[model samples]
Target: MIDLNNIEEVIKEEKKILRNKSKNYKENFFEIKNFIEKEILHIETLKKNGINIIPEINFKDLSPSLIEFKKEVKNRGCVVIRDVFDDNLIHQMNKDLESYIDENNYYEDQKKKSDIDKYFSDLKSGKPQIFGLYWSKTQVNIRQSNELNHVKKWLNKLWVNKHNNQTIFDPNNELVYADRVRRREPGDTTLGLSPHCDAGSVERWIDKGYQSVYENIFADNFIEYNPFNASYRNETQEIESAAVSHVFRTFQGWVALTEQGPGDGTLQLIPIAKSMAFILTRALMDDVDDNDLCGSKPARALSVNSTYHSLLLRGLVSIPKMNPGDTVWWHPDVVHAVEDQHLGKGYSNVVYVGSTPYCDKNLAYAKKQSKKFLEGKSPPDFAAEDYEVNYKNRAEISDLTPLGKKQLTL
Candidate 1:
C-alpha cells in the first residue's frame, strides 16, 4: 500500500523528527524558566528572614557540596572548582596534543605564515582571522563535537543532581554549541580576547526566555532572592526572544585537562555574578560609583554594581594556579580573561561549553555553523587559527578516523 521509493514518504517520515524537535524546544526553554523563577523566590525568603546564603563546595561528597556551591554561585552569580577532571586522562591528552603541534611545526605564529602581526592585527579591527595551527588529530577527536555530547551530558547531569535530582535539560533535546580549543605555549599572547559580553548581552535586551534567569532582579523587591525555586527555568514571560530555533547558551564552560599554573595560563573569574550583571546592565545609566548598586556587598569587601566593580573585577580575576584534571566554570555575566602563558613551558587546554538558550536567533547561528563545520570553517565568534590545520586540509581529516569522523563528515 506504501510507495517505498517515494520522496513524499521520506518527507512524511521527517515530519516526525520535526515534531520531536519542537518538544525539545519547549523543554529547553522551560528548563531555564523554571530554574530562575524558583531560585529568585527562594532567595527572597532568605532575605525576609535575615539569613546568609553562601555555601562552600568541597570534593569529598559532590552532591551536597555542589548544591551549596551552586547557591553561592547564584548569589555571587558564578563559581569555579579546581580538579574536576581525571589527571591521568589529561596527561595523556596533553601528551598527544603536544606531539601533534610539534610534529606539524605549527606554532601560534605559523597560521599567520609566521606573520604574527599580519594575522593578529586583524583581531583588533574586529575581524575574524586565526593564523595559528588549527588541525590536530587530538583536537578533532577529543576537543570538537566528538566530545561535545559526552561533556554536555556530564554537565547536564551535574545540573540535575545539583538541583535535587530534577532532570534539567533533556540530553536528547536539540542544543547548539559555540566552542573552541587551543594550545597556548609559553608567552602566547596571541589568543587575547578583550573584555566583552558574549553575543553583546543579547539575553538581557531581547531574549525574554533568558531574561527569566534574572527575573528576581527585575522584581521591585530585592529581598526576595530565592535560592531553590524551579520557576527560573519554566515560567513564561513576555519577550521578543529570538525564535530562530537555536540555542545563546545558558552556560559557558571548559575542561582544563592540563596542569597549567598561575603564569601558565590557567583561568580567572570575577566572583560576583548578580552585581556584575546589574552593573553591566546599568553601565550607561550613570558615571556614579557602582559600589552603591546591589543589595549589600558580601562579607568580602566588594562593590554591588558599578565601574568601581571593574577595579575589583581586576583583583578577583585571578588564575588559581591549577593542576592537571581541573575543570573551571564561570558565568557569562562576569568578566573573564586568560593570563598569557609566560612560564617556560605550560598549557591551558580546554573544551568550551555554554548556556545557550534554545531559540530562533541561535538557530540561525547554528545553521551557519553547520555549514562551517562541513567546509572546515570556524564557527561564528570562534577565534581563528585555533584549528587552522583542520581548515586548510579537510581532505586529510576526511580520511583519518578522528572521533566521530563519519558523523561529522556527513
Candidate 2:
C-alpha cells in the first residue's frame, strides 16, 4: 500500500539534507574513525580476557544510589538484570509452558509454528520449536506477573526526558506489548536475525517525528545526542505493517525461561553509545550513493556489520550467562542480533517483554491490543493471524492481574 514514488522523493530530499551537511559530516568522520580504532582495541582486550561488556545487576539491588551502574547501562545501551523473578517462579513458569505445549499437542500442530523454521529448516527437528501462539496461560501469567510489571516500570525509569521539563508520559506507568515466545531446541539456529536496530528502519530518517531521535547526528552534533532522551518518540508513528513497531520501547527486554550463555543461543549486542553516532555519520559520508538512505527502507531490517559498520561488528559481544529467573534489556536503538547457533544441550526459551511508558501513542496501541486479546487475535502491529483462537486452556480476562487489567484496560 506504500507509494514507492513518494518514498523515492523523500529519499532524495533526505540525501540533499545530508549533502548540504557534508562539510561537517566529513570533519566528524575522522574523529569517529580514530575513536573506533581505540575502541576496537579495548573491546578486543576485554574479549581476550573473557570479560563481557554487557552490564549485569540484580533486580532487588537496583536503586538511584547506584550512579555508576546506571551510567554504564546508559552508555552500553543494554543490561542484564538477574533475579527479576524468583527461581521458583521461573521454574514453574517454564513447566507451565512445557505442559501447555504438551497438553495442546503443540509440537505436532503445524499451525503453531513460526517462520523461523523455514529460514533454518536444515537445522530444525521434526518438532516445531518457536511458537506463535500468544495468550497461552503461561504467557499471560508471566505478562501479568507483579515482578515482571515492576521490572518494566524500573526499566522505563532509565530514560530521562530532556525537552524543556515538559513531561509527556509517566515512566511509573507501563504498557504491555503483546509479543511471541522463542523456545529454541538444542543446536537450533532458526533465528538468524542479523545485527539490526529495532523499532524504526527507514522511518528513522524519513518520518519527522522518528527522525528527531537522531537529529543530533544528522546535524553533525553527534556528541550531544543522548539515546536515553525520550523526545518525539511517543509522537512518532509507523505505517501499519507487520514489520513496523507499533510502540516505542525504551528498553526491549525478555524474561529467560531457561539458562543460556555465550555460544548457547544468547543475544549479541554492540555495546557502545558512540557506535550509534558513528553509524549515522558514516551513512552520510560523501562516498554513499544518493539512491540509498544508508540501505534503509520501510519494513526492511537495517543491518549494521562489517559491510556498513565494521567497527561495530568487531565490538559485538554476548552477555554473561543467564539463568531462568534473569531478565535482559537493551535500548531500542541498540544494535543487536541472536547467536547464529545454539550449542547448548537444552531448549533456550524466553518471552519478549519491553518497557513502554504510558503515552498517547502507546496507550492507543494498548487499547487495540486489549481488544485483540479478548478476540483471540494478534496485536495491531502484528499480522492479524487467528492461530490461537480455538486453543485449549488459553488465558482469559479473569487471568489478568490487577496491573495487567489496568494496562489492558479490562
Say which candidate scores most in lDDT: 2
The predictions' CA RMSDs to the true structure, in order, are 13.6, 3.2
lDDT tens string, model 2, 1-410?
A: 33455887776687677546545667777777777678778878989997878888888887767788888888888889999888887889888888877787766664544452232222212223456667887778777788877777777777875477788678888788878788877888665456777676666666778667777767667668788888888878676556457797888888899998888876888887567667766776767676565666666555575657777788888878899989998888888878878899988889887777788888888998898899887677665555667777788898888888887878
* Cα lDDT computed for each candidate against the true fold: 0.43, 0.75
Worst 10 residues of 2 by lDDT: 118-127
- Off-target runs (Cα >4 Å) in candidate 2 are 21-23, 105-129
Candidate 1, lDDT over the whole model: 0.43
What is the TM-score of each predicted model, taking all chains together? 0.56, 0.91
**How close to the true structure is residue 233 of candidate 2, measured as C-alpha lDDT?**
83
